[model samples]
Target: MVDFTFNAKEQEIIREIRREGLVLRKYARYYDEHEEELPPDEFPEAKEFAHIDKMAADRGADATSPTAFYMCMLMHRTWGDMMRMKVPFTALGNASVTAAGTDEQKKRWAKTRLSMANTEPGCGSDSKAIETTAELDGDEWVLNGEKIFVTTGIRAEGSVIWATIDKSAGRGGIKAFVVMKGTPGFELVKKEKKMGIRSSDTAAFVLKNCRVPKENLLGMDPTVKKGGGGFKGLMKTFNLTRPGVAAMGIGNIMACQEFVAEEMAKEGVAVDYEAGQHKRSAIQQKMIELEAELEAATLCTLRAGWLADKGKPNNLEASVSKQKGGDISRRGAQLALEILGAMGSTHDQLVEKWFRDARITDIYEGTGEIQRLVIARELLNYTSKDLT
Candidate 1:
């Protein structure tokens, strides 16, 4: 019951995923070079692959739960291209709705492509400093503020914006509002030129007296409690999402590791686990260390997901996973480049692209510094006020 090994059916699915990944790998470089071009929804080879339903139907009755298997698939699938295939059109706001919205709100917005806006010109990781304001106006809530670095803002049907009703109340007054695209005063300011993950659309937004129905307020809670109930509720979504972010990083790192290992093997520099660390060459020892770190980060990520699947609180574990995953990704990419020498920096290879992509892992979804702060406060039994 506690086994981590993939069964026959899961292995089959993974094989299928790998088969498809090979095709997607062909376009990775093209998209990386032409950041404005979007990948096609369906490739020529897409028809040959089994759909999700078919894959599910193929599962053996005695097979272990697919959660861990799926996580592994995520890593393998992304390994080919250093990016997740954007097949499903879900967004971060979808998770927010699932986590905090009322039943009616969930039913209405769950399927909509929704981006999340949290960062502002002045605030990035310090979300509590968000200056966006929301005022209740008879039948609607008028919002006014500028949000920067809104992922998918250009393409999403709407956005889940974090704005405060009472800035004086601190976190307690902060709330999420579902502002649909084409809202009169909500404007797409411009797309951001990012260092990596260029294929993914990142845009800035200007909300000037943008009004949405009062019912659009997430959880439909207007009260700003002293305990910061609204803010806490919104943050609960991150307990699961942080681990997902870590998984993305792990996937990208795994891609770099696999690429390096393959290239090294061709040069007769294969990793030898049978040899002692002292007996192995410097390169071999470094590879072994990197592999160990990768395993540690992977295990931490899986533990966080497992806890969440079991309906257990994973706030601390999620932070741990994110911190480990982000650091590993950044370092792993650098090590990969070092191993490949100047060849790694060439655009002809994916190593450089991965290196650029990995840099964002430590910066987004809360920076590595922020994650450490969370872990420290949790471990020391200190509140945000006590530590920060």
Candidate 2:
């Protein structure tokens, strides 16, 4: 039941995604150097990639699980750039909407690109400590807050803003609302200059007495439960995305591995599968080790998916996969650069850019340290850590 292999159809689809991703790869450095420019909504070369969701892949009884298949799809999609695609991806909040939004809420914004406004100037990992507030007046809810480091904030037609209705109620008071771009007081304040992934826009927004119909509220429930049930439901979206983030790193490193292998081949450093350690060069051994490490992380990602497909909770495993992914991607990219020496550091090669990109894998979605804490708490059976 925990098999790590992809079926024929699943493998074919993933291969297609990676092949199409090459078009995006060609532009990775152009946008990396030109951080102010956002990638086009669609690349003429890889237009078919934008419709990959429409591909009909019928798996036989031996097909891969839905969760695993989705992870692979996301993984290969980012084989070129971390989050950049030939097409702009629907913001992550879309996943939150699909998971926690009410039926009417889902229908209302089925195709809207909705950014997530969660992190604030003072809050990053501690989401519950958000200072944003939501006050109801009449049939509208007034919002006041500043959300920073929003991905795709500039391009999203709207955003899902998080504000606490009753700060004292803690997590239960935190709620999600759909706020359109031209809302009375919602404004895009900043488009951050990030260290990497410059192809995608990371924005900051300020909401001043912004009001939307109360029905815009996700879950459409105002009663704040003591256990923060509604808030937890939205957080589950992270469990789904953490591994996805990891898979992106995995996909990137796979590209790195290919690049490195090709470079080595050019230098007559051919990798011999049958060669013993005594016969192989140190760099060759390192390449093999990197492959093993990548394989290990890849398996962790699939395991998280496997757990989900089995209808089991994967909170702990998600963190494990993400931690492994972030670690290896950072390590793998750095090692690739080191092996290439000065050329690796030059803009002439994407390996240097990937090295910069690898740093973020550990920082976003949840830091590698936070993931460790999650794993520690799960193993010890301790109560949830006080993230607030």
Clash pairs for candidate 1:
none
lDDT of 2 by residue, 1-388 (tens): 5776777777777777877877777888778988998778877676566456665356668877778877777777777777564654577788789868999888878899998888998988878898999999999999998999887899999998888999999888999998999988999989899888788789999899898999988989887868888889888878888998899888888878888999999999977779998999889998998999999998899889888879899999999999999999889998898778888888888888888887888988888888898888877887564431
Question: Which residue runs does candidate 1 get wrong by more than 4 Å?
Answer: 50-67
TM-score, cand. 2 vs. native: 0.93
- Candidates in order, TM-scores: namely 0.95, 0.93
Alpha carbon lDDT of each predicted model: 0.84, 0.84
Residue 111 CA displacement from its true place in model 2, Å = 1.3
Candidate 2 worst ten-residue window by lDDT: 48-57
Q: Report the lDDT tens digits of candidate 1 across residue range 128-240.
A: 89899999999999999999998888778999999999999999999999999999999998988878887778989999989999999999989986878889888887886
TM-score of 1: 0.95
- Number of clashing residue pairs in every model? 0, 0
The true-versus-predicted C-alpha distance at residue 80 of model 2, in Å, is 2.5
Best candidate, TM-score = 1
For model 1, the local distance difference test gives: 0.84
